[model samples]
Target: MTQQHGETAEVRRDDGELIGMLRQVTDGGWVPCAVFGLPLATPRSAEAARGFLLDHGLGYLADRWEAREGGEWVTVQIVEARPGEVTVSYADYGHPKLFNERRTLQEPSPDDLRRA
Candidate 1:
């Protein structure tokens, strides 16, 4: 996201959907592509950037997700998944009904892993 300066690499999902492009900045740091509203990590090497994306890529959208609402963690449904912007709705373990909320994808709440 930083001004797009440096070498670039294309990262894709298993299904060949573009996750995002890694941008190497002037500081010799590699920035991984963003997915599902997740934060962009600036890694020191392109290898690290690619590894991070391959491990936690767009596939995350298919997994169950939870969100904090009013200080309580509740299961939510991902209504939409896109780079930098994601929409979620409060789920009742059935169909999601309620306000569609736009979240920064800044928080990840999985069973054993936490991501930013």
Candidate 2:
């Protein structure tokens, strides 16, 4: 994808992982957030997404991931992250209930990298 001035792109790893490559607007620099994997199915709701992260023992505080919708992937900002728990808000899934609900993935598990 072409790099846009105000926008960034991320690749969703096969195992329903959230990976981010953030570009700073002021400095035009790129930084990579370590990849995080969700143990549960693709979260259909916000709450489920949060729970999956927490259960997986991935870093919770200030951790973020991307979510897919309508063939487009968008960023899901983690408002709360802690051991055994995570909470996120999506740019699109705005309904509090639907937004707060967890989702399931349509396909099977994909390959993923394990951190050392």
Candidate 3:
């Protein structure tokens, strides 16, 4: 999946082969965070980051592969493997219907305030 940021695009690869392109936002001198399809609002910690990604229905922890200095690979087992869809929520404050249907903010009359 391609992650669109603004203009520049960074090619992403899976298994050492080009799969898709992700847009770049800022230069970090290494791998751009946008390449992972994560927004800037993502938490900085690894655990929080993983949780946010999972909550947003991106990818899940299928298995973890760790490599040692000797080039040995270790695989960790995954309990769940159900992938879900990603959704983003937003509010349109400038819509004409929304503004028209909203309740008006009016100060109560002196008599009404006295009754309260």
True-structure RMSD, every candidate: 6.6, 15.7, 21.8
Top of the candidates by lDDT? 1
How many clashes does each candidate structure show, in the order listed? Answer: 0, 11, 0
Model 1 poorest ten-residue lDDT run? 107-116
lDDT of each: 0.57, 0.37, 0.27
- Quality of model 3 by C-alpha lDDT: 0.27
Model 2 RMSD vs true structure:
15.7
Two-way lDDT contest, 1 vs 3, winner: 1
Q: Model 1, 1-116: lDDT tens per residue? A: 21233366667766777665576778887777555434356565877887777777666556666676555566666667664456666654432443354454533423312232
Give the candidates in order of lDDT, highest first.
1, 2, 3
TM-score, predicted candidate 2 vs. hidden true structure: 0.25
By TM-score rank, best first, the candidates go 1, 2, 3
Each candidate's TM vs. the true structure? Answer: 0.49, 0.25, 0.20
Misplaced by over 4 Å in model 3 are 1-43, 58-116
- What digit string (tens of lDDT, one per residue) describes model 2 on residues 12-57? 3446454322223335434332232233232233333333433543
